[model samples]
Target: MDRAVLRDDMVDSLEHEAKGWINTESVSLAMRSVPRHEFVPDEQRAYADCSFEQFGTRVLAPSTAARLVEALDPTPDDSVLIVGVGVGYTAAVVAEIVGDQNVQAIDITRRLVWEARNNLARAGYNGVLVDRHDGSDGLPAYAPYDRILLEAAAIEPPQTLLRQLGASGHLVMPLGASTQRLVSVSKDGTTVDEFGRVAFSPMLVDGEQVDTVERNRTVREDREFAARESEGRHGWEQHWIDWTHGQKH
Candidate 1:
C-alpha cells in the first residue's frame, strides 16, 4: 500500500482499538497526517504497531506515541521540546500539530541526531530542530517550550526540563527506574498526575563517566573496579603476606 493509505490505516487502528487510550483530536489528526514510513527503513511494515529498531534507536510503537501526544495536548501555536528524537517519527507527528518551526527535539546519540535531522527534513519537517546533546540537561537555546514530551523513561523528570516549561505548559514522560509511569507535570512545577504505567528504554546521558574508585554499582562497575582498583591494598605490607600464607593468630 502507498504511504497515504498506510498512514490512514495506522490512524484508524489507533482511534478504534486504542479506545480511551487516545482522547484528543489533535493527536488523532497528527496520526493521520505524518507519514511514518519515511522515518524508518521498514517501508513495507512501517504502519505496524511494533517499534522498528535501528542504529541503537527505535521508533516508538504507534500506541505509545499516540498516548504521549494525547497527554501533551499540543496546539498549532505551541512550541514543543521533545527528548529522544529516536528516528524522528514522534517529532514529525508533533510537528504536524504544532507547526514544524515550533518543534525542537534532542537526542544524545550523535548518529541518531544526524539521522533524525535528515529524516525529518526529507519528510518536509526541515523547520524542526533535531540536535545532539545531553537530554537530561535540556536544550537551553530553545527554552520555555509550551509542551515537553520525553520518549525515553527517566528515574525522575529532569529538573532542567521542568524549568524550561512556559508558564502554563505540560511535561509528560514515562518516569521511574524499576516501575514506570506516564507522568504529567504542570509548568508551575507542582501539579502532577499519572496517565498509566508504561515500559520504555532508560533515558541515556551523553558523555557521562563514573568514578572508578566508587560507583553505585552495575555489572560494568564491578568489571571496571577489577580492572582499575582491585588486588591492591590493606595498608600493611606484612599483613598481605600473612593473609596469603594463611598465618592468622
Candidate 2:
C-alpha cells in the first residue's frame, strides 16, 4: 500500500473512532505531516493498521496517541517534557502541536535517542531536541515544565517529576504495576489531582545502582542459588522488576 494512503487511512479511522477522544485541527494536520511509517522498522509497515507493534513498537497507536495529545491540550506557551520519546514520532507530533521550540524529548536508550534525533531531522521537524537520560528521572535543569507527557507507564508519579512541573502544569503517565492508566496530574502547590486510565510501556531509568541490601532479603530462598550463576546486582535477571519498583514512591 502507498505510505501516504496508509497514513491517511489510519488518521481517518482514528479520528472516527476517537470522536470524543480528540478534536483539534492542528493535531489532525500533525498526524498527516508525521510519516508514521518512517518511525517503524521496514518489516512492520504492513501492520500499521494495528495500534500496537510487534517489534520496535515505539509510537503509540494513532487514536491512543491522539487521545493522549488531546488530554494534554498543548499550547504554544507550553514547555513539554516527553518521556520514553520512542523513535521521536510522538515528540514530532507534539512539536507540531506546541511548536518545535517548546518541546524536549528524553529517552534512556542511547541508540533510541540517536535514532530519534536523526528521525526528527530527516522528517524536517528540526525544533524538538532529543536527549539521553532516564525517562523516570525527568531532566532537572529544564524544570518547571508547563506540560509533561510520558509515553511509558510508572507505578506512581515520580516526586521529582512533580517538583519539576510549573504550578498548574500537567503531567500525564500510566499508573500501576500490571495494568495501567493514562493519568493526568495537574499540580496545585503541594497538591495534585489525577484522572483517566491509560495503558503504556514501563518506565525505565538509564542507570541505577542495585540495592544489594534489598536483594539479600531473598538469600534464604532458592533465589540466592538462582542468583549465583548470574552477574551480581545489576544483571538483566532483575532489571525490569527493579525498574518497576524504582518508579514507585
Candidate 3:
C-alpha cells in the first residue's frame, strides 16, 4: 500500500475514534500529510492507530496526538514548543500547520533527539528544531511560544515551561502523577485555568534520564540502614521508658 494512503487511513481512524470530539481540519490534514511509518520502526506495522516505541521512547497514539493538536489550535505563523519530541512525529504534524521554522521540540534522551532530528529531516520537516534538552526548562532561547504542548504527564506543567508561553498563548499537558488528566491551560502571564485528564509518560526531570541501577542500589542501602536503626531502637527503648505509657515513672 502507498504510504500516503496509509497516512490518510490513519487520519480517518483518528477522526473516527475522536467521535466528533476532535475533527479540526488543520489537525487532520497535518496528520494525513506526515508519514508516521517513517518515524516508527520498519519492522513494526505503522499504519495502526496504536502507540509504539521508537528510539526507546513512546509515541503518542494517533487519537491522542489528534486531540492534542486540536486543543493546541496552532496557526501558520504561530511559534510552537513541543516538550517531548518522540521520533519527531507530533512535531511534524504541528510543523505542517505552523511553518517548520516556528516549531521547536526537545527531549531529555540524547539518542531520541538525534533520531527525531534525522526522522524529521527525512520526512521534510527539517525546519523543525529537535534538540537534547530538558523539556521542563523548555527552549528558552526561543522564549514566548504561541503554543506549547507536553507529551508527558506532570502534576503541574513546569513553571519554566509555563513561563515560556507567550501572552495570549495556549498550553496542553497531561496532569497528575498517576491517573493522568489531559489539561489545557491558557494564559497571558496572569489568570490560569487547568482542567482535563489523560495518561501519559511522566516528564523527565532536570533533563536527566532515570538511572535504574543507581536507584536500586540507594533503595537497598536505605533499607539496610533502616533495619539497623530499628534494631537499636528496641534495645534503647527499654532503658529510656516513657512514664506516661509505662508502669515506672
Candidate 4:
C-alpha cells in the first residue's frame, strides 16, 4: 500500500478512537489533517496505532496519547509548550491542533530534537518551531505560555515550569514517581491547581543526583515492581518482562 494511503488510515483510526476521548471539534479536524504515521519511524510505521515513543525506550500506547490530547484541550489560539519531545510525533500532533505558528516543542535529547525537526518538516510542518533544551527547566525564552504539555512524568510539580505559564494558562503533565497521573495545572498568579491522573513514563533530567525525592521515588518504584513480580510467581517468568513498560522508562 502507498505510504500516503497508510497515513490516511492512521488518521482515520485516530478519529475513530479519539471520538469521545476528545470532544473538541478543532482537535478532531487537526487529527484528521495530520498524518501521524509520517512522523513515526518507518520501521515502526507498521504499529502507527496512536502511540508515543521515547527514543529506544518503550513506545507509549496510542490510547495514552489520545487521552493526553484530550486532557490538553489545545486550541488554535493557544501557544503550547511541549516537553518530552520524543520523536517529534506529538509535536506534529500538537501543530495540527494548535497551528504550526502557535506550537513550540522542545526535548533534551539532541538527536531526538533533530529527528523531530526533520520529521515535522518532512510532514509539511516546516513552519512548526521546535528547539532542543532541558525538559525539566522548561523553556524560559518562551515565557508566559498559554498551554504547557509535558510528555514525561515528574515526581513533583516543577515550580520553575509553573512560573513560565501565563496567567490562566493550562499545563497538562504527569505527576508523581512510579505511578503517574496526568494532571492539568491551571496557573493563577502564584497558585496552581492540579487534577486528573494517567500512567506515564518518568521525565529525564541531564544530571544524576541521589537526593531525598529521587531516592524515595526509586524505593517506591522498586516496591511496585516487586509487587507485580509476586503476582506473576506462577506464570512464565519471561512474560513478566513488559516490553511496553520497558520502552517508556
lDDT (0 to 1) per candidate: 0.79, 0.69, 0.76, 0.67
From the highest TM-score down, the ranking of the candidates is: 1, 3, 2, 4
Backbone N/Cα/C clashes per model: 0, 4, 4, 8
lDDT tens digits by residue: candidate 4, 1-249: 765565555555656644445456665566666666656555454346644434544445444566677778877768888887666666777788778888888876677778778888888888767887777788888788888888877765667778888877877888776556777887742324444567765666664221223422333345566887887686335564667667322
Please give the distance, in angstroms, between residue 39's alpha carbon in candidate 3 and its true position after superposition.
0.4
The TM-score that candidate 3 achieves is 0.80
TM-score for candidate 1? 0.80
Q: Which stretches of candidate 4 lie over 4 Å from their true place?
A: 1-19, 43-47, 50-54, 188-197, 208-249
Q: TM-score for every candidate vs. truth?
A: 0.80, 0.73, 0.80, 0.72
- Residue pairs that clash (backbone atoms under 3 angstroms), model 4: 50-62, 51-62, 57-247, 58-247, 58-248, 181-198, 182-197, 182-198
Better of 3 and 4 by lDDT: 3
Candidate 3 ranges with C-alpha deviation above 4 Å: 188-196, 210-249
User: Which structure is stronger by TM-score: 2 or 4?
Assistant: 2
Worst 10 residues of 3 by lDDT: 211-220
| Candidate with the greatest TM-score versus the true structure | 1
lDDT winner between 1 and 4, please give it. Answer: 1
Q: What is the lDDT of candidate 1?
A: 0.79
